[model samples]
Target: MTKHFKSAFRQEVAELVVDKGYSIREAAEAMGVGKSTVDKWARNLRKERNGEETHDTPISEERRRISALEREVQQLKMEKEIFKKGHSSLDVGLNEKFALIEEMKGSYPIKSLCDAFEIHRSSYRYWEESSKKIRPEDLRTDIEVKAAHELSGGSAGSRTIATLVTSGGYDLSRYRASKSMKRQGLVSCQPPKHNYKPANKANITIKNNLNREFSPISPNQVWCGDVTYLWVGDRWRYLATVLDLYSRKIVGFALSNSPDSALTKKALSNAFKARGKPTGLMFHSDQGCHYTSLLFRQLIWKYQIKQSMSRRGNCWDNAPMERFFRSLKTENMPKNGYKNEALANDSVRDYIYRYYNSVRPHSHNLGLSPNEKEGFYWKASNWLARKG
Candidate 1:
C-alpha cells in the first residue's frame, strides 16, 4: 500500500531541506516521506523564489508559495498602518521613527518594523532604553528653556536662559539648561565683537571724581549716563540713558535725532525730575562733546550735582551705561533697526520700562531684575528704619 501525507506536512519537510539546510534524506526520514518527494517539492520552491516559471509544481510547493503571498499582504497592511500614523516617508526624524516603533512594538515584530523603517534594530533598541530613562522634569526644563529663549527675542544664551528659568521657580542650573538647549537645537543670536582703543590721559580739566565707582549705597546717589546711536528710517537717532548705580536701573532715557548737549541735558532733567530732584547726586559720563559741552555744564551746576567725566576715549569710566546699552541692542532691539523715529522711541521705551527694568534678569543685580532689586532694597531700608 502507498503512503499518503498532507500538503502542509510535505511543505514542512521540503522547507527543512530548502530553508533549514537539512539534507533531503534527513528531511524525508524526519517527515516519513520519500526522498524523491522531498526533492521534487524543494526544486519547485527554489524555482518560484528565483523568479523562474515552473510547470507541474507539486501541491506542497503551491502551498508554500501561498504562504509567502500571505506574508507579503500582511507586510503591506502594516506599512499602510504606519503611513496612517503620519510616518509615510523615511524623511521623518530618527526620534520620531523610534517613537513610532515603540508605539507599534506590541502589534508588530520589532525586527519587521525596523526593516520597514530602514533602521537598524540595535538603534531602535538603544533609543527605546534611553527614552525610558528620561524624566518628565527634564522635558519640562526643555520647554522652559525654549520659552525663555523666545522671550529674549532669541538672543539670550544658556546662562541667561537658565537664570530666567530659575527665577521662575524652576531651580534649573546653567549646565542643565545648556544641555536642554543643545538637545532642542536652540541657538542664540550673538552680537559682533567690539574693540576698544587704549585710554589716553584726562584731556579736559574735569577730574574723574566718580573714578569708576559704579556701586553706591543708595539710588539717586550715583548715576551714569551714555549715548548710543539707533538707525531710524534714513537717519541715525541718538538715545541717552541715565542709570542708577545702586540698582542698574534706567531711571531716565531720551531719544533724539542729534547727539547734542540738549539731548544729554534732557536725559539728565528727566532723571532729576523722576527721582524727585534728589540732592547730593553725582553724574558720571564719558568725555563725549555732548557731556562736556558748556550748556550741559550749566544744567549740572543748576541741579547742584557733581559732574564726573570718563578719561578721554575711555568707556570703562561709565561701564554701567555701556553695558545697559549693549543689553538693549542685543536683547530686544531689532537687528535692522526701527522704521521711524516714533517707532524707535516706542521700542526703546518698552525695552527700558517694560522688559529691561521689570522683567530681564540682570547679573549685576544677582539675577534679580532692576525693579525687584530696588524693591528688596526699599523693603530692607524701611524695616531697618522702623527697627532703629
Candidate 2:
C-alpha cells in the first residue's frame, strides 16, 4: 500500500536473488529500485529465511506466520476448554479427561497440557489402560446403583449400594457408586440414635461373662437381648428381641403387654428353637429383672447356655441390641403410633422378618443385610464341610 513492494513481488525478488541465482545488486538494478532499497529488501528476505525479523517482516511473514498463529490459537482454545471442563474433574472422571488429552495429543504437548490442567501423567496412563480394558459387567454401573437404591427403599447409602450392586453381579466401587448416586439425586436416610434407659435392678444379678465382647465368629455363638416399649392404643406395649451377635439379625422376638421374665424367656425360647437348640451359645443382656430373674436363670441352665449380663448401669455393653431397637423405632415405627397391640405386633413381625432381616443393610455386616450375611456364612460353611 505504501512505497514498499507488494508481498508477491518481494517474494519473487527474494527468490530471484537467493533461489534463482541472481545477485542482490543485479536484481536491484533490474527491478529499477535504488541499490540501498534492494539491499534492504535482500537483507529482510535473508532474515525471513533465517527465521529472523525483516524490515518488511510484518507484511512478508504473514503467509509463513499464519500456520503457527493458527496453531497457537488452537492451543489457546484447547486450554480454555480444559479450564471450563476442569471445573469438576470428578464429574468428568479421569478416563474421559485422559481421552480428551489423547485426542489433542498432536496439537499440544501432553505433559504441558496435563500440567496446565493439573492432571498427573501417571494417573492418566493408568486410567487409559483401565478404560480400554473395561468389561461388559463394568457398564451400566450407575443404573445398577440406582436400582440398588430403589431396592433399599430409597434409603441405601453409597457403600450399601455398592455392596448391593456387587451382590447383583455388577463390579463397582463405593466412591464411583457414590458419585453415581449423587448424580442421580439419590440420598440415604440418616439413621437415628438410640436412647438407653437404665435397666431395672432386681434382687439378683450375674457376672458379665460376655464382657462387651460383641464380635463373635459365627451366628448363634452369642446372642444379645433387650426390651423396649412402643405406644399402642393408648397403652405401652413391650417388645423383646434376641439378636445374633455375628449378623445383628433379630433371631427372635416377642411382643407383650408386660416387660417381665416371661416375655424375655419367650424370646430366648424362640431363638433356641429356631436355631435348632444350638449349644455352647452365650446370652447377654442388662441386669434387668426380666433377664436376671430366677426363672430366666433356670431356663439358661436348662439349655446350658452361658448367661452374660452387662455391667450394673452401662448400656453400651449391649449396644447392638440398643441400636437394633433404635433402628426398629426410627425406621419401622408408624408415624402416628400403632392403633392397637395387634397392629403393633404385626408391624414388629414385618420389620424383623421382612424388612430388617432381608432388606435393611447393616453397617457392621459390611453393608450386607442380616439375613444375607447369615445366609452367606451358612452357605460357605456347608460348602467347606462338603469339600472337606
Candidate 3:
C-alpha cells in the first residue's frame, strides 16, 4: 500500500520544519511521515517562498515574476485602503488600527493587514477580544483628552481640558474630560496651598489707599508691587514685580539676591521710568518690611507717587499681585527651581514679557492677554482723543 496526502496538508506539514524551527526528523516524527518525504517538502516550500523554480513546484520564470508583481499590486492596494481610511497608520493608536483591521478583514488577509500596520498578530488578537466593550468614539475622545492634558504640561483641570479639546474641534465637555482622565489614571499637577499666618503690623502708617479696588480706569493710574522668592544656585533669590492694575500687566520687574527696600525701590523705579514717570500714580503693596522701610518710603516721596499699604496680614487687599505670583509659580516656574541665576532670570523674563504678557489669557481682562488689553485701551483712548 502507498501513502497519499493532499497538497495543502503537505505544505502545512513542511511549514513545521521550514517556516517553524522544527528539524526534518522532528517534523517527520510529529507528522508520522517519512524523513525523506519531509525533507523534500521543506526544500520545495523554501524554493517557493524565495520565488525559485523547483521540480515539484515547476513555476516558470515569467510566471514567477508575474506572481511577484501581482502580490506587490495587492499589497499596494491594501496600503492605499489603510491610508484612505485612517489617513496615516502612525497617527492612530494600536487598538484603533486593530479595529480598522477588523473592519477590513473580509477584504484583505488579517495577517497581512496586521503586518502592514506594523502591529503584532498577538497584539491584534488581544485587542480584538478586549475592544468589543469599548466604543470607538470613546477611544478617540480619550486620545484627544490625553493629548490636551500633555500639551498643558499636565496642569489643566477638567474644565480647561474640555476647552482645549473644543478648541481642537472635538465636542468634549468637562464631564467627559473628567471621565477620560479617571479612566486613563491621569491627574493634573497642582501647586500646594499655602497657610498664611498673621504677622506684625507695619511700623509706618499708610492706610489701604487703593482699598481693594483692583480694576483701575486707565494705564498708570494704579500699580501694585510684590516680592516672591525663587530657589536658584542652591539658595533663595528674590523677584519683585510692578503690575499695572488696569491691564494686569507686569510693567517692571527686578531680580536680586536680597529681598530688601532696594529691590522694591528698583522695581518701582523701573515701572516709573517705563511708564514715562506718570504723576498722581498710586502704588499698592502688602505691609512687608521691604515696602514699609524708611528707604522705600524716601524713594516713594522722591517719585512723588502716593503709597497704599494692604491691611496687616491681609493678602486679599493686594489680591491681584498675589494672583499674578500664583500664576507664575504654578504655570511657568520649574518646581525644583532653576540651576543658576542667569537661567532663572531668562526664564522669568520670557514668562513676563512673552507668555504672561502676550499669550496667557486673563479672566480680569475677559480672556484677553495683558498686552492685548493694554493695546485695546490705548487704541480706544487714541480714538477718543482724536475725536475730541
In order, how many clashes per candidate? 0, 0, 0
Top model by TM-score, which number?
1
The lDDT ranking, best first, is 1, 3, 2
lDDT of 3 by residue, 1-388 (tens): 9987776678778889977899999999999999999999888777777867675632234444666797799889878886676666457776568778888898888888888888899998887786557788889989998997776556667876776677568899889899799878888775677777745454257988898899889999999999999989899999999999999999999999999999999999899999999998999999889998999999999999999998888787888999889878876678898899999999899888876787655778875778989999999999999999
Clashing pairs in 1: none
Clashes of 3: 0
Q: Over the stretch 188-230, how does candidate 2's per-residue lDDT look in tens digits?
A: 7747554666653422447778877888999989999999999
Regions more than 4 Å wrong, model 2:
1-147, 176-186, 192-204
Worst 10 residues of 2 by lDDT: 54-63
Model 3 residue runs over 4 Å out of place are: 1-154, 158-187, 192-204
Q: What is the lDDT of residue 220 in candidate 3?
A: 93
lDDT leader: 1
lDDT of 1 by residue, 65-174 (tens): 77679789999888777767644676888877887888888888888789878899999888878866868988899899999998887878888899999989899999
The TM-score, computed over Cα atoms with residue i paired to residue i, of candidate 1 is: 0.67
Error of 2 at 340 (Å): 3.5
